[model samples]
Target: MTSDATASPAGKIALVTGAARGLGVEISRQLAALGAHVIVAARDRRQAEGTAAALRAEGGSASAMKLDVTSEADRLAAREAIEAAHRRLDILINNAGILIDSPDGGTPAERQPSEARESDLRRTFEVNFFAPLRLTQTLLPLLRRSEAPRIVNVSSIRGSLTHLSDPTSPVYPIRALGYDTSKAALNAFTILIAEELRGTPFKINAVHPGWLRTGMGGDRADMSVEDGAHTAVRYATLGDDGPTGGFFFLDERLPW
Candidate 1:
């Protein structure tokens, strides 16, 4: 790993998975707007190119690369592409995820357990947990090359044990067994990784972007994609002194 020992996040290079659309696209847009050279990586080359084109139209340093988060080869190719162009990766946002088939308004949490399927559980964890873990491990050396690196995992309030336990909490009643449990597993990875990197110049954190009105969140959700990407962008560009091994919503830390 090359060392700057003094580089700040400004003018740094960033790679965001699933950056073709939705929250991932929004986060890439915001990060590039802040002067970072952002790599938009997604499974669909066409969509990734479209996003990169949009960013370039807005006068940002952005590029598109085909990256299927679940594929190790795709992950390595993305890393090679980034390294060839920028030499080091300063920010990583593991935002690629999927939600299995659930009804439009969503079945109540109690009812969800009954309706849950085994395939749904496996698929959700495959995308939400395994992929991120694999991608992060593959790109860690790139992250270590930076002077002050940041890793932001887009998690959710539904993953919070505290919120899930408290009967008075809003999220207590909103669990989708597979998706919720997968995010909780992702949250565990965030904490463990952060602890492992303790005392380093890197900050790793999980952010709950609130309920967004994206394809996954449905129309009645409170936040727009614009607002939903804010916490993610913040977490990605956090300072050297910023918090790690923690869950956040904007600036507030949430209970485990």
Candidate 2:
């Protein structure tokens, strides 16, 4: 990896999952902009390399790797690549995710008893809950090598059980059990990992990027991709004294 032409990535490296397009792409771009040599991870080697190429052309240090978060082989290879190149990973942005397409108006809780399918629930959990946790666990040793490690789980506001339960909450407009519940599980992982890492220099946090205009976010989203990425970037680059095990959107502490 080449050194940053402008700012030094503080001599750190970062890996962002699902960086082929949408929020993942933007997040990888922004991290590179901050001077970190980023690994633009995606399921497709072609797209991943293309993204890394774009970054390199623009004067950022980056490389591409195939990382299907659900597959152990890919994850292991990604870790090995990072270890070989940087010896340690300073930041990890678990930005890959999906939103199951549901019928308009959502699967209301009242109707969930008969409408929700086991397969739908399973897939959502696999991507949103288990995947992030598993990746973090696999990369812990490499992260521990860094002077300051940061893990930013790209979550959603709907993931908050607190907000979902509040009838008056702004998030009430959107509801999908498969997606929402999976995120809730992810948030729990974030809290537990933060607790496990307490007294250490590492920081782990969940962030709500808000509704964004991505393939999953649809067309009605109020926020741009740049706006959605702000919180993730902030959490990824927090100072030594920054809050850990916290839920946030931009700078605001969110209810979990």
Candidate 3:
């Protein structure tokens, strides 16, 4: 791995999943602005196109792709498309996630851990944990071809066992068992993969995008989408010296 701190992303290729809107879109915009050819990937092709078009309008190199991370077919198609076009994927931001335990457009409720249904837990894990893992595994070959490959798993502070165990922690009161557990699992995957790829140039880390006012974060979130995307963007474009197998919020390392 080249430890060049001044590395540039000018000729790199990146893919941001669930980038039709919210933090995903912001992360795509930032990566494109940094001179990478970014693929705005979402389940909705039209929405992805719109986001990619907007990024291009801002003088960035970007395109759209349909990627429903949970589907095996979509995963294969994404790999094929990237292989045909860029031939390598330099950066991957696994930003697609969900919070299904919350009530649908209604008042929030305190869901007990025991009250979380098996179906809800399974669906949450499918999207939040398993999907990213499957997609990353599928793209590992392309990522391996890059000189400096990076994988940023967009996690949440709510997933932190350290925070959950502390009564003083702000996330202590927020108990969505399904979402929290899935993110925790995602973080674990980050560590496991980073360790496996330790001697290589691949930099993989789990990041907390901070609580933002997105569809999932609800209206009362403390941060903006732009601010929320900062962590993922920073780690996505990490220099060769950047840390791997870690959890970070912005530049600050978080307790695992």
Candidate 4:
């Protein structure tokens, strides 16, 4: 394990999953800019390394790691690597997620809850819900070693139950059952874990990065990747007085 003096100046270490492209890439960049030694983890090692190289070229501290969150072997390897290097992790951003049933391309012309397949649901849950929960559990020990640990689950506003049920809600008319439900489960996990660690220095919360013009959000999205990344970056670097077990978009708390 590396000594404290060898760690980042802030003594902060961050690991971002699916950091090769899109919002994950932007999130990694922003975190690195804040002086955190960022780990740009992705299933593809080459892509991950490329992202890390770019960050380093821009004068930010970053490195690459191969991590397929859905694979147990990869998860164990990631834990071992972190333990061997930093010995502690200050921030964990679960930004890796999938949208298999996106409306951009649907068999029935529009993706709907009624027409969603079981396979799609299971696959979506595997990445969005289970992977984050398992990774957090696996890394909890390292996180405990930090003076102030922060876990930011990158969720979506579509997971909001209130918004989904209300007729007036913008997302009420559009339903991507698999993706939305998985994120809702992730939000629940955040709340449960935060409550379990309530009195501790750990701050766990879910943030809805606005619908950005990423591959998942599609070209019609109103926000840019940089704009979408701000919320997660803010929460990931939160102070000791920051709120936990909450759902937020920027500074506003959203309905569960």
For this target, which candidate reaches the highest TM-score against the unseen true structure?
3
Give the RMSD in angstroms, all C-alphas superposed, for model 2. Answer: 4.4
Q: All candidates' TM-scores? A: 0.93, 0.92, 0.95, 0.94
By descending TM-score, how would the candidates be arranged? 3, 4, 1, 2
- Whole-model Cα lDDT of every candidate shown, in order: 0.85, 0.83, 0.90, 0.88
Candidate 3 C-alpha lDDT tens digits along 1-256:
2234335677789999999999999999888888999999999999999999999999999999999999999999999999999899999999999888775212243568878799989999999999999999999999999999999999988889998789998887767888889999999999999999999999999999988888878787788999999888888888878889999998789997
Could you tell me how far off, in angstroms, the CA of residue 256 lies in candidate 3 after the best superposition? 1.2
Model 2, 2-113: lDDT tens per residue? 1121223455789999899988888888888888888999999999999999998888888999999998888888888888887898999999987773532232343352
- Candidate 1 accuracy as lDDT: 0.85
- Give the alpha carbon lDDT tens digit for every residue of 196-239 in model 4: 99999988999999988888888878899999998888888777
Question: What clash pairs does model 3 have?
Answer: none
- For candidate 4, the per-residue lDDT at 248 reads 92
- Give RMSD (Å) of candidate 3 vs. truth: 2.6
Model 1, span 1-256: residue lDDT tens: 1122123355989999999989999998998888998899999999999999999899898989999998889988878887788888999999998877465213344337777788888988989999999999989988899988899998988889888899998777776788788889999999999999999998999999988888888887888999999888887877666788989898688988
Flag clash pairs in model 4. Answer: none
User: Against the correct fold, how does model 1 do in TM-score?
Assistant: 0.93
* Regions more than 4 Å wrong, model 1: 1-8, 104-111
lDDT of 3: 0.90
